[model samples]
Target: MEIRNAKETIRQGAPSDESSKPDHTTKMIVYMTIASTAAEGLTGICSVVSSFLNDFSME
Candidate 1:
């Protein structure tokens, strides 16, 4: 009886493991996209600040 219960648990766990793989991949992709977008925004802000400083120094 214990062996039968264990088998049932394993069978349930198997489908969850398979489903989690794609969910994990999707979460990783989303994180990467957010990181890249933040990097682009930071670079744009840095360039604008540098240009402004250059103009101020020239004056």
Candidate 2:
């Protein structure tokens, strides 16, 4: 009986551990995606501002 209970506990715990691993990975991917998007937006804004300044200086 005790061995059976132990086996059941291990089976349940294994799935929980596997599920948690994917949750962590998903969170990391979401964070990285947000960071990359923000970086791209900032770069685009900088480029536009630089072009505007260059045009202003030429006039």
Candidate 3:
């Protein structure tokens, strides 16, 4: 059916649309996202460790 063909066309076009972005910019975005996520996770771990240390110190 025509609707099915149209859906297929849209699916094929999606990757091209995404690929149109500059590769450097995409890499920067991905790297920044990874870096920020890692930093946030580390911060949370440090906070928990600090809290535990503080509790031990209070005893």
Candidate 3 lDDT over 1-59, as tens digits, reads 99999899998875676678666977899999999999999999999999999999999
In model 2, state the lDDT of residue 32.
99
User: After superposing candidate 1, which stretches have Cα over 4 Å from the reference?
Assistant: 1-22
lDDT value for candidate 2? 0.89
Candidate 3 segments exceeding 4 Å error? 1-22
Model 1, span 1-59: residue lDDT tens = 99999899998776665676655777899999999999999999999999999999997
Query: Which candidate achieves the best lDDT against the true structure?
Result: 3
- Compared with the true structure, model 1 gives a TM-score of 0.57
**Which of the two candidates, 1 or 2, achieves a greater TM-score against the reference?**
2
TM-scores of the models, in the order given:
0.57, 0.60, 0.51
Q: What is the lDDT of residue 2 in candidate 3?
A: 100
Models, CA RMSD each: 4.7, 4.8, 7.1
> Sorted by TM-score, highest first, which candidate order results?
2, 1, 3
- Encode model 2's per-residue lDDT on 1-59: one tens digit a residue: 99999899998775565666645777899999999999999999999999999999999
CA lDDT of 55 in candidate 2?
Answer: 96
- The collision pairs in model 2 are none
User: Per-prediction count of colliding residue pairs?
Assistant: 0, 0, 0
Give Cα-based local distance difference scores for all models. Answer: 0.89, 0.89, 0.91
